[model samples]
Target: MTEVFFYHLQKQSLEAVLPGLLEKAIERGWRVVVEAGSRERLEALDAHLWTYREDSFLPHGTAGDAQAALQPILLTTAPDNPYGAAVRFLVDGAPFASAEGYERLVVIFDGNDRDALAAARDAWKRAKAAGHDSTYWQQSERGRWERKA
Candidate 1:
């Protein structure tokens, strides 16, 4: 079964939390696909991932970029996996109907948005119904992710 993790973002924005997770995935030698909710959002994230920090780098690209398939981290709005990534991050309430052939799936949602929260809950229910191994993580007051029952 595919392992699924739901990250409820309350304190920090997705821009803050995503890089760290992507870095970890890279460290594990897992190619990644970050599925955004829209093209504009994907473009914003593509730019942000490149220049999120002055010192560090998280190499990524979109389908429009040349040699996109070779990117270690590919960002897209489509449901298709272009880079053959084993790990996928679903942001902005991007739809995920199945977890087939994925090693892991990460769903990040804004805790403040009612629609996003509803979407997250729906995703959780689908994951559970599909019998995927799922876990939930919520940020603490100190701004650290902690697993919740």
Candidate 2:
């Protein structure tokens, strides 16, 4: 069964939080695919990942980039996993179908967005029904993630 993690964003924007998560994933030596809600979002994240910090870099590329397979992290708006990632991140309310091949699936949704929250709930139900191990995480007042469910 796939391990599914749901992150509810309330205090910070995805841009503020995603880089840290991606960095951790890279530290774990996990190939990753980050799926956004749109091409614009995907592209924006692609750029952010490059310049998020002055001293750090999260090596990644989009589907159109050359030698995409060599990238440690791949960004896309679709469900395609060209890099054969062990982890998939569904950001900005991106759709979730199945976690068939991935070792883990991370769903990051904006807590302020009713639609995103609803979608997360539905995804949770579906993942549970599919016998996946699921966890729900929410940001605390101190800006740390707390496992809520």
Candidate 3:
């Protein structure tokens, strides 16, 4: 079963935290797929990942990129996994219908958004009911991620 994790973004914006998480996944030698709700959001993220910080950037490509199969991190709006990713990230209210072939499924939602919170809760419930091991994580005041449930 795929392990599901909910990351409740409160103290930090997704831009502030996502690169680090992607780095960690890459460190683990995991291929990743990040799915967004819109093409504009996906395009923005594709650009951001290349220059998320002045010092370093996560190597990634969108589905339309050449040799997408070789990208360690892929960003796409498509419902299916294209890069044979081991981990999948659903952000910006992207719908997660299942986690069939992935090792991990991470759902990141902004705590300040009521709709995002509702959707995360629903995803949690569905994940639990499907027998997927699920955990909830929230950012601490100092901006470190802490597992809350």
Checking candidate 3 for backbone clashes, the offending pairs are none
Local distance difference test, per candidate?
0.92, 0.93, 0.92
Q: Global lDDT for candidate 2?
A: 0.93
Query: TM-scores, in order shown?
Result: 0.97, 0.98, 0.96
Ranking the candidates on TM-score from highest down gives 2, 1, 3
In the order shown, the candidates' Cα RMSDs to the true structure are 0.8, 0.7, 0.9
- Model 2 pairs in collision: none
User: What C-alpha lDDT, on a 0 to 100 scale, does residue 133 get in candidate 2?
Assistant: 96
**What is candidate 1's CA lDDT for residue 28?**
96
The number of residue pairs in model 3 that clash at the backbone is 0
Please report the TM-score between candidate 3 and the true structure.
0.96
Give the clashing residue pairs of candidate 1, or none: none
Q: What does candidate 1 score in Cα RMSD to the true structure?
A: 0.8
> How accurate locally is residue 103 in candidate 2, as Cα lDDT from 0 to 100?
92
Indicate whether candidate 1 or candidate 3 has the larger TM-score: 1
